[model samples]
Target: MTVCAYLALGSNMGDRAEQLRQAIHKLNRRDGIRVIRISPVYETEPVGFVDQEAFLNMVIAVESDLAPEKLLETALAVEQELGRVRTVRWGPRTIDIDLLLYGDKMLQLEHLTIPHPSMTERAFVLVPLRDVWEGGALPVLNRPVDEYLRLLPQENKGVQKWGTIGWETGFDHSES
Candidate 1:
């Protein structure tokens, strides 16, 4: 069965924008996964660990036949291939791929969670997500993502559009 899923991508280490683009490219190349649309990239301040560099963030809508766990494994492998090292919680990284939603299926497993637990509270996640979000209520929130976006506190103004991904010349990843 094919399922539509939203994945949030972020990077704060070593050519952040290029890292994100490469990650997206790798995801699209994966079997049974096709990237439908990508949100405008956003630059945001680090949340949990403020001692790091700013992060480049974006969301991608994908259609995949891979099950949730398989999809998660794909994401993890992509991250590892991109040089992601998990040293700290919410720490800086070369790339971060989060499975935000998986076609209305709510799940809680040891290695994965659908609709990412902290997504609703983070503007970095919600803002870019709102960009690619099609018309429908988020499965876990049970309300439109925009509604949840509005309910969040306004203090986190860190999320702002960086630019369109493929159109931007600064994201040339071929040399790396």
Candidate 2:
């Protein structure tokens, strides 16, 4: 079985851009997983924990044979590999990988949730996510990316496309 998964990547500690790249690389390298499309990296002001440096964030689209639970475990492993520390909620981190959507499947387990609970509310997640889906639509929300972005609170956090990372840098996600 193939699942169209959406993941949101963000980093606020160390080389933020590099951390994001590493997280994605690790995801791609996992068995039974392939990255389909990656949105351009975007820089945004920190949300919630207001006094930290801005974060470099992006969304990745992947097709995987792994089940949702296994995928969540894979994401956590990648976070650990990238030096992520969970000292505080919404705290600084070397990397953060959130499974935003799982093939239109709604999940609620002890440690994971599909169609990520807060995705619609976060501008950082929504903008880049829309970029990855070829048609710029969110399958889980059934809403256009443009519309979802507009509904976010009126904050001036800006997001812009940075570039791509090399395959050898971290994990590998093959593109078809």
Among these predictions, the greatest lDDT belongs to 1
- lDDT per model, in order? 0.87, 0.81
Q: What is the C-alpha RMSD of each candidate to the true structure, in Å?
A: 3.6, 3.2
**Lowest lDDT block of 10, candidate 1:** 167-176
Tens digit of lDDT per residue, candidate 1, span 21-80? 889889888888888888999999998789999999999988999999999999999999
Q: Candidate 2: where is the Cα deviation over 4 Å?
A: 166-176
Q: For model 2, how many clashes? A: 2
Q: Give the TM-score of candidate 1.
A: 0.91
- In TM-score terms, candidate 2 sits at 0.89
Scored against the true structure, residue 14 in model 2 reaches a CA lDDT of 92
Encode model 2's per-residue lDDT on 58-169: one tens digit a residue: 8888899999999988999999988888988888989998999988798888888787888888888887887777765677567897887887768743676666655323
- The top-ranked prediction according to TM-score is 1
The weakest ten consecutive residues by lDDT in model 2 span 167-176
lDDT, model 1, position 12: 96
The TM-score values for the models, in the order shown, are 0.91, 0.89
